[model samples]
Target: MYENKISARQLRRMIFIETFGAGALSIPAFACYKEQNGFWSLIFYGVFLAGTIAFFIIFSGKISEENFENRKIGKTGLARNVNINVSKMQTRLKSINFPEVLPQPIKFVYMIRFFINAVALFYFFGKTIQTVYMPESSFLFIIFPAAILLCYSLYTTLQKRARFLEIIFPWIITTYFIAVILSFIGIEKAMQIGNAGELWQGILSDNIFRSMGNGYLMLLCSSPIEFLLFLRPAAEERGTETKNRKVEDKNNKEGKNNREGKDDKAIRDIITAVAGAILCNVLFCFLSVRTLGPTLTSQSEWPVIKMMQLIRMPGGFLERFDILPIIFWILCMMAVLSGYLYYGWSIFQTRSGGCLKNFLGITFVCLVLLTCVVEKHTLLWTFYLKYKAFVDFPLSLILPLVVWLFKRQKDFNYQEKT
Candidate 1:
């Protein structure tokens, strides 16, 4: 029964893996380049504090239809909310209502932004892979495996894919941390950890806009609302930690109020995931200055890689091993690609009523590949994202309003019926 399903912890890790993907590698340089030593404070503020608010805003819409709780994962790559309480079919139908004017426009806007996100991420990820791991390999060769993994994640069980991320992601992070420490410790003689004051001075200036933007993008990229698409409430016979709260407070108890436990758990998981992203970004930013100093960090091609190359392993039998951060980066970039592709495919399926299927999946991947091959330059793709950046702001701000309206209507009807 749980074949294609993941536990709450796994879902949280998936968000972490997704959030830390493309941005973590590059954001540090952007942060340091923009704010230097003071980048640390901005990372905390923009990515963590603001990000948590964004997650809550999106989730506060309250999407629990316990009467329609059908967690079955069937063929055709669709897991739907089967309305088993057919006697209340009218209310269930009412609950799913769309705004009179926003239905088509909403779907269109969502797809366009989602498409732009997928394309930019895919191209950059593939380009980064080539630049780092296999410089000699053809561009198509670098992207092929990533495309395959993305397709599998989309067409197959997301739970299985999420579980895989849950298991291996920790090790990848550990490896990254070890590499960073080794790089810093080995370069202690050359390191100049001072001049962080300038970063602090610049924090409030217009100069910090790029740093803030980088942090916000890191948070935005792995938004928690998408979690709703795959969510089926955690099975609670006795309820876990939340049950303790339930058993502790009898006076607070009301009919079906226990459902709120899942809501709390979801919020906790989102906080955990966003915290991880914040840490990774901070560490990467610190890695730049801690190794290369503030001034030098701004002038490098990939400053993070430069920091990594400082690691000098001492050994007799192994001789002196060299640095290899490309492995970690390649893995991260691949994760970013999968995250975008999976999110886009999920929304497409929901909107198309599963008609797109694998055909939609194949076409999307091909478009990315074709574009990369044709353009032959990653900078153009980055420029495209900047040009179309307006697509994302409205999605984040507008969709939450829609969900809020939906919830308001839902509660009014429920109160009238009760």
Candidate 2:
């Protein structure tokens, strides 16, 4: 019943906010631990992340969003929802004559991927808030508001979400850059350009896995773009039913023009994702060591807050600039939390379609809360790193390649048939 579309610029803003925010604070330490030179860590993160995003952009463009639109999409903004009836088929399903009742693996895998990304992020945000920001508050108290905001975001149209991000993107940049600039006061002038760290070949051999873990944090920070948002049928899509309309437009449009139009969009999509990832990440890592020396940067737990705290604005304007880091954390965490909730709820709908969606949604939220409350946050962090090392790397790389290749094969077969 709802219809929404956003410009490519709006989509780019959303990606920027998500990819750059939360990781900017704590991840430098993780990267520093892995690389002896410290510089290679920054370079590795950029190349590793840029490649993953580039693959996603090219693949998302290759498959038209309209293909998803041509079918009935769930409320979650994704394409696939396997609605299986197991009642009558309970007996037949046991007999292996249950193809119809079988769960779809692709949908299941994507669903799992989105949930893992979301939950890991959700836990991180909650932990940050619980520890540094609000030590007195209970875990549930810190997480509750975020959960509500996330639910609200999921209910709104994607265009609205993008629009909200556009408004905040500037302040996010201003606050972050100001902190980076002020950070110069804390470290030596000459060391601002280069960090003090020993160089070694351990980067390629020993510290590679930890780098993968940190790189995964960066990659999943903003989360991958949801292709169905574009591919699904827009309200204007059905207008093509008018034959006279198609003929009139066909007469006016040349093949070259159509190809150029698509190329323009494809280029914008790639350039935006790549540039945003690199720029945000590079500035973040550079500022980390430039603002705080390598030893301190690696030692500090909440580097963003620590880095921002050291910068005292001239004229004694405010007692402390530490609040800037908090603002940054809140902004980024809200966006990330909402994205996770949306993906999680969407997967629930895909699995159980009806009132069960409501039940499962509530259950999912509660389970996440319970896990965060009972589980030690440090242990959870370790599990997240291990998951990234084992699952996320292959999943992020292989999924897009498989999808892109599959699309190519389908196109080749269609051309042969025609």
lDDT of 1 by residue, 1-418 (tens): 3443456787677667765665656655555554454354345446454545555435443433333231222332223344343332221101221222134556566556655666666776766666766699987776666666666666755556666777778777876777666766666776656565755454555355555565554445444334443443332222343443444323234424654765567657766776777677677766677677666666664677777666555553222212345556666666666655665665666676665556756655675566575457656766775654454744655664675566668667977996
Q: lDDT per residue, candidate 2, 1-418, as tens digits?
A: 1234445566666666666665767766655653432566666677767676666555554543222111222243233235633321211001111111214564477666666666677777777777776889877777766666666665666556767877988888788777666566544343455322332333344455565555555554434444322322111222233432244223223533543464466456546755775676666566666667566777876766776666655677766677776787679767766665554555455565533436546645764665575345567678777776678656755665565565568667877996
Model 2 compared with the native: what TM-score? Answer: 0.73
Displacement of the residue 352 alpha carbon in candidate 2, Å = 5.5
Q: What total of clashing residue pairs does each candidate reach?
A: 0, 6
Best by TM-score: 1
Q: Which window of 10 residues has the lowest lDDT sum in candidate 1?
A: 90-99
Q: In angstroms, how far off is 39's CA in candidate 2? A: 1.1
Please, what is the TM-score per model?
0.74, 0.73
lDDT (C-alpha) at residue 41 in model 2: 61
